[model samples]
Target: MIYKVFYQPKPEQVPVRENTESFYVEASSEREARKILADKNISIEFVQQISGVFLEYEKQNLNFKVEQG
Candidate 1:
């Protein structure tokens, strides 16, 4: 499965709507995805599982690439 991770670069900083960063990770589950990012020290806002129509839409984006952790 693929997950969309929304986060801020620093743990102490608040996420701004326009400044938030995101990436896609391939993991077996949401918990596994969170665990994979634990060492990065970023402030995680959301970990969403992507599939079906939404996954297809994301695939159309040029920047959509899943990171292998």
Candidate 2:
């Protein structure tokens, strides 16, 4: 499955609208996805599972790229 992970790049910084960034990751589950990113120095905001129409729509975006853990 694919998950859209929203996070702040700096661990010490609080997440703000403009400062937050997102990426797509392939993982078996949300917990697994979090675990995969555990070592990265980033503050996670949310891990959302996306599929169907939502996934298709995201794929159309120019910035859409899935990161491999």
Candidate 3:
């Protein structure tokens, strides 16, 4: 099962000179993913299991279309 991990710094934690992105990761299992994050010294504040995947599409709107279909 895939999981979404949210990492937030602790109130009393000291700053580290590392670049940790505030995002999520998908893994085979929650426990494995947590271990990976811990190995990187990242504290996971929250973890949510994702039931399935989602897709999104986007397009830009322009004025000069010349009677676009």
Candidate 4:
């Protein structure tokens, strides 16, 4: 199964990238993904676990969109 990992930087002062990112791995769960990110020392402001592959789209000054495949 594919999971779309939604992440925002921990610092609100930092600008977010236009497109949300997805990382593919054979992990069993969403928590595992979070753990992996944590072990890598990547700080996240927010995250969501989504089903299937997704296309990223951006809306200015609003939440990013993840379109599931």
Maximum-TM-score candidate: 2
TM-score of each: 0.90, 0.93, 0.47, 0.39
Model 2, 1-69: lDDT tens digits are: 999999989879867979989999999999999999999889999999999999999999999999887
1-69 per-residue lDDT for model 4 (tens digits): 334455543534464675444344334566665666664433454445444333233222154443322
**RMSD of candidates 1 onward, in order:** 1.0, 0.9, 12.9, 8.2
Model 4 CA deviation exceeding 4 Å by range: 9-19, 41-69
Give the candidate order by descending lDDT. Answer: 2, 1, 3, 4
Clashing pairs in 3: none
In TM-score terms, candidate 2 sits at 0.93
Where is the poorest 10-residue window by lDDT in model 4? 52-61
For model 3, give the 10-residue run with minimal summed lDDT: 55-64
Local distance difference test, candidate 2: 0.93
| Preferred candidate (TM-score higher): 1 or 2 | 2
Candidate 1, residues 3-67, lDDT tens digits: the string is: 99999887897778677889999999999999999999899999999999999999999999999
Clashing pairs in 1: none
Candidate 3, 1-69: lDDT as tens digits: 545555646524654435332444556677766766775555666666555332111012232111101
Q: Over all chains combined, what TM-score does candidate 3 have?
A: 0.47
